[model samples]
Target chain A: MRSRADVVVIGGGIVGLSTAYHLAKLGADVVVLEKGYVGSGSTFRCASGIRAQFTDEANVKLMKYSVKRWKELSDELGYDVGFVQTGYLFLATTEDEADVFRRTVKLHRRLGLGTRIIDMDEAREIVPILNTEPFILGQWNPEDGKASPFKSTFAFLMRAREMGVEVHEYTPVTAILVENGEVMGVKAGDRTIKADAVLNATNAWAPLVNEMAGLDRELIPIKPFKHQLVKTEPIKPGLVNPLVSPPSWNDSYIIQDAEDGGVIGGAGVEHGPTYDVTPTYDFLREVVRWMTRIAPPLKYVHIIRQWAGFYAKTPDSNPVMGEIKYVNGLYIAAGFSGHGFMMAPGVSEAMADLIMKGRTKVPLDWEWYDPHRFERGELRTSAFQIG
Target chain B: MQMRAPKGVMVLGQTDGEDPRENIIICRCNEVTQKDVEDLIDRGITDIEEIKRLLRIGMGPCQGRTCIPLVMGIIARKTGRRMEDIKVPATRVPIRPVPAGVLVGELDEE
Candidate 1:
């Protein structure tokens, strides 16, 4: 509604706000159009588990870059992002799984991460409440942490605003104005906010937005899977401070918040891809079944709350970043799966660099995530999981 | 009969029956206290939806059935927003628990 801007980032979640913040910092006029309140999307509903224990090189590099940024984010943004490095522990049961994890540990060490494969005894030492009967090996990175999702999103929004970015909540982008296969502007509500470039950070709803540009059929389906998480009542403090990834991922991960001491966890995320965020009774049941064996203490723990979120899953579980080659000035920043929350710092910097300087100096190779990679039959796999 | 109560010792016992405040639980499921809602409002959470997401006021397994009105009342009173203006987030399906048995047969999801 401000007539026009240098760029229009469609989506006010953390990704869009981070993009706007970087773009505005680089002296570009940015207008963020949020269909709902900022962070009201999957940003606020995520389990807020920030980890760097990845099997893929690209993901590991991105998260390794992110962990450093998160450490310095509060100072940079002038707001406490509530980053707590409680560590992320993965439980491996089978011998084959443990062997794979041992190799992963070497890869992690080479990447400058402190991820080491510890025996079951060390796992119990790390988390006193952990039930070690189900597992033999554990993978842990002492530095992998989580932050306040709402706080970080709000901080990014504030910094972006301070940099002169105009954020319009309740402003849904209706269409993207294109001409001659070149980028143009975006239509939001009744007004046309003309711009030379546009970034699609609409996550789960990217498919609908892609349709406006007449590029729907060409892209791989980024389905929206409904994932749910539950929070337990404040439990007595124990050594179980680190976030524990259940053996086999078992559709669950448990972590006690540093502040509230509330054990936040979830499982049974095999829920089908739908816009429906309805938390099912199945999740509560699964939580009980898994919690009973994973952590004996949580068997009868009261589930104080439960909420659902969307995992914007791509064909390979890897995000499709960088620019859409065929569409000039049109950048793709969504499809980060569940890791989008933690990887925002790196992704935003790369996207901003690509938009401003025509390239990113970040260690990541953007070509691997090209939107047209599927067309060339080059599907990349990522080791991250969602519950 | 000998006096059993210690003179200066703090009595550690259930006080719900003695103190009216202890029994007054806004959201019985989430155990949200009235003070909790007010404290959130003090922190500048004017919108109902924002409060819902942050405090998990209406996010229990009962799906806000018991807490929505109570939370809305607190928000409406504090923010001066009319009840109609402070909309409750729509409750989605599977309001009741869906047995895993239902989801097991259809493993091949496209």
Candidate 2:
């Protein structure tokens, strides 16, 4: 069986669904294909941490717009993305680190962001259990918060459908159809999908999809890195806001879920040779050590469950966005390195605008994130290096 | 976690201070066997990848959520497989199970 659509999205993740939703709003016939359940990829396993405290101006602007969209997503999608305004508290345990925080805060404030640097005492007041003895200053942004990645992705899927987007879950793309060195569509199972435009938003599996399309693409610089986060058994809430560790170490950040009392925390773990998402004892031990060091209250709290997720990393640790140069009708929106969940809303919306209206109004510089940047020796370094 | 041992499978681990011969298993996700794992190397399924394929040690719905560590310990018992050889599997999203029906319901097909 052969099908035709105005646009065929290669993956049914949050980014793909959001793009479909926006494209359909512009009256385009969109079809989304999924290899697994919707939100089952990186979307469901995401930490769902949204913030505008980024060091890079482009990232800060992307997040700033995304935070706004998130605030009203419930009304837009008719389902809560679980946007909590609990705020993000990034602490600086040393004076030199404090200087960095101050510089970041200045940039943030200059951009009209409500981020401010506060003393350790103020930091302790925000998150009561934070041990300020090791910190001299902190960055506070009351607008930053965590959300339910599952619910958000699901909401986008539902809303996209309501806007007339077709989604096929468990339907893997067996191959991408290209003719005369241009993408024509995709082949899923025995069915051939003829598409006018194809968007690849497969996240960690972008490389595989690109290969299936037979494009001479070198996403060769992109690889997967494993990261693990755990939730402790429900206990008395020790912290009111998210606590980002001083200088971003293995125990990068920990925050209490506002909807569920479970504490959500992340630890940095290295990638193995093969694609392995299994949890590790090393991560558990290091996370515990840092968690206890920063917040003594977590020492006795037993971990209830832990899961690992892969951050699709590029050579520069930044996303590879924009259209592929050789693939005439193919667009690339993958490689978000651990920050996909937060960046999806804005990136997807931007891609949708660029595809439908031929331009994007968002502050995102599509040129900087071009898929051909690596070949041209251009790389954008990510500011946040920790988990 | 309570695990009923599958047929022809021997229970492994501390046994929670209970009888080791009882019909109870350590990892519940994949019905792996202590004896099956022990015989893995002799059966030519020596490495972690081979063990994972032979006995379904790390291929369950949880994707070795509870059992990978146990399998790692069993592999660690053998001095041949280095500590670094027991690397963790790649973590995909939707950590917990979600209804496939919900995903299907999201699409607006003709």
Candidate 3:
């Protein structure tokens, strides 16, 4: 890239580009290095589900803030992100899950989220295609919605570039140069761009980037696990309103993509700590079974595309944000556990505040996501994470 | 050198037919023409995975079954790299569209 810049962001996905946009807005010269094209990482494989429903107060607050930003992101980016406010419906299969969901709903409402524990009838009404048999209880939040990944991410990338940010596609950050525990520059491709600040936005590749800066032990529990999402061919739209999910956390998510008429969702797996992002036949079968049950109409809609991408999962299935304790001028906005695509705006803005000032407007204890949390066994887990 | 066989019919730079197939639609599922793929290659998307994502070439209903050979041939010729060296992304299973009944059977195994 350029011989010098104020900050070098490693990764051109939504998180990286959003951080670049926020950093540029803060009057910092930024260069983004992406080995692949923008929106081609975990972003491309997203089902585009956005929700404010979480069991933990930190996540609930973070998602509430994220939802507020997403509602107005279209206007800010000057492009239609296809932000269809289809709401989010969580189906609880067992009595225990129903009890947990009810408690979670109360907590969410107290946190200023319009979440409620609803009956199966309401769930079916929201998404008429839902079978409503296996679900004993459902949680509905009309404020949550979905957005198009490619369009929204490209919007951030374009806006960042327009704001004097240098984004180099096909230029991967090979190494992060640190001197005296302070940031220096990054070796991207062949050129070394000097940076007083460096952001490790490389979610799945966090280990590799941190190792370059001699901070490998900080994120020892972070690993990239493959998740597969499938899409059906253009079906008649409006069949499903809210994104639907089964109680079996990972294996159940079904929502409509407003941009294209295809209904998109995923088949979740438990085995991980592997970087293999290969789509398996197993996922297709599981997805079909779980999704069709939630929305029976999916049985007829033929799947058009199947793809897999990485989820940079931390040990607690939550994100690791903020700066490394030992490295000055080095910040982390990685390990989002597949929620990165939906929460990019909030995370990016918070990271920008953390880098520019020592604090963030995000009211939650953003420091809880510190990379060193694992070493101290101070991990905070989010109870609900729909793959 | 991973000696993987070409996945589809090589048609990008093939000169066998009298009418130039260069302008023809190779990925019928996604309506990706030869020119569309070549332009992506010109922009340095020589890798098959990038070409699929950017141009939507091999990401359609038929997957890459109809377009891989045409793309691989063009990439090899353009980049001066041997076919073995050209890395194509993984070809996932469920190659044929399975009926709902077969899918249920797979779920039952779990």
Candidate 4:
């Protein structure tokens, strides 16, 4: 049996759903296919950290637009996205690190991002528990915040559906029906969805879809790494903002979820030789060690719960967007490197523009983030790629 | 200790009818009930693997970190097997949750 639609979007993650949502808003007949329940994949497990801190102007611009959309999400979607503007604090413990932060903040200021390089004293005022003893400088962006990935994606999906997007969950894309060197549609189970355009929005599983569509391309080698999040029992004192140690000491950050009265936090623990999202005793130990070092009051707090999520990696540690070279009627928007949840809205908008109107104001035309950049032998490294 | 019987198997010490113990939840994320587990067991899902496959009890984001031990205990009590006799689910590598940012950074470095 076969079904047809104007567009068939594979993968129901935030990126896929957001793309479907935008396409629907553009008055296109769209259908979303998913192998699992909504937000159950990488989206559900996301840390939900949204930040505008980026080394690339394109990423900064996209994330800035995302932040704008996030600000209006509650009104736009008619649901609370749990978007809290607690801000992002990037601490630097060394002079070299401070220099890098200074340069980034200057660029951010030029873009009117309102980020500043503050001293230990100002950083202390924002997050009182920060271990200023080890850090001399910090990059403080008062606008960066966190939100619930589930709620945000749900909002988008709901609003998108209201705008006439059809979504099918637990429907796996068995194959891509391509002919004459172009994508015809997608086949899910025994159902074939015919469409003039196809989008490969599956994040970690992007390479498989690319191969299925016969695109001579692969995602940015997004290796799935696991990290654990531990939540402490309710305490009296509350944290005001997110805290991140110097990139050298910790490759991750922690945030306080006052909604549940628990200090929910995690770090980018070292990855092993494989892609597995299992928990370990060593992770629990390191989490306690670091949490204690950062927030002394948390040392004695009993850990009530813990869970793991896979971090998808890209080669440049930035999201890969825009059209692929060889495959027509096919677009690629994967390899977010763990920043996809927050960047979904703006990224999807840009992708929708490129798909519908052929050009976008979202500045995604960087040669570094080019879809075939690796094949073209061009790689630009960005320094602000923190977990 | 709360002597509530494991969700579905009815291991000798459970409250009567309808409401099971709120604290005794199977698959913390999905909240699969004790009755849910017992139904799965009665339907020939006595083994942990089969139970997980049928009920999706311990296959959530936690990946059986907390629920597996309890599931093993339940299976032990019901099948007259030791807790050690019940095998733990397979543990894979990258044995911690990671942010996508760090994962990508590591890949870029490689």
- Highest-DockQ candidate: 3
Q: Lowest summed-lDDT stretch of 10 residues in model 4 chain A?
A: A215-224
RMSD of 2: 13.6
Q: Candidate 4: how close is chain B to the reference, as a TM-score?
A: 0.67
Tens digit of lDDT per residue, candidate 3, span B76-97?
8999989888777666545654
Q: Residue by residue across A263-345, what tens digits does model 3's lDDT show?
A: 88776664467777767878877888877777776766666667788878888888888888788998888888888987888
Weakest 10 consecutive residues, lDDT, candidate 3 chain A?
Answer: A215-224
lDDT score of residue A292 within candidate 2: 60
Per-residue lDDT tens digits for candidate 2, residues B1-110, read: 35556555655653444444233343565456666677655544344543553454554446577777776776777646766677765553345533222222322322
Per-residue lDDT over A195-274 for candidate 2, one digit per residue giving the tens place of the 0 to 100 score: 98899998788888888877543653567778887666455654645646555554367778665565667776666433
Cα-based TM-score, every candidate? 0.85, 0.77, 0.84, 0.76
Candidate 2, clashing residue pairs?
A: A45-B94, A276-B89, A276-B90, A277-B89, A277-B90, A277-B91, A278-B89
Candidate 1 CAPRI classification by DockQ: incorrect
Looking at the true structure's interface, with contacts defined as alpha carbon pairs within 8 Å between chains A and B, what fraction does model 1 recover? 0.07
Residue-pair clashes per prediction, in order, are 1, 7, 0, 14
- Candidate 4's C-alpha runs over 4 A off are A216-220, A272-275, B1-110
Highest TM-score among the candidates is held by which one? 1
Positional deviation of residue A203's Cα in model 3 after best superposition, in angstroms: 0.8
User: What value does the lDDT take at residue A270 in candidate 3?
Assistant: 40
Number of clashing pairs, model 4?
A: 14
Share of reference contacts found in each model? 0.07, 0.00, 0.20, 0.00
Lowest lDDT sum, 10 consecutive residues, model 1 chain A, at A297-306
Query: Candidate 3's error at A373, in angstroms?
Result: 1.3
Question: What i-RMS does every model get?
Answer: 7.2, 17.6, 3.8, 11.4
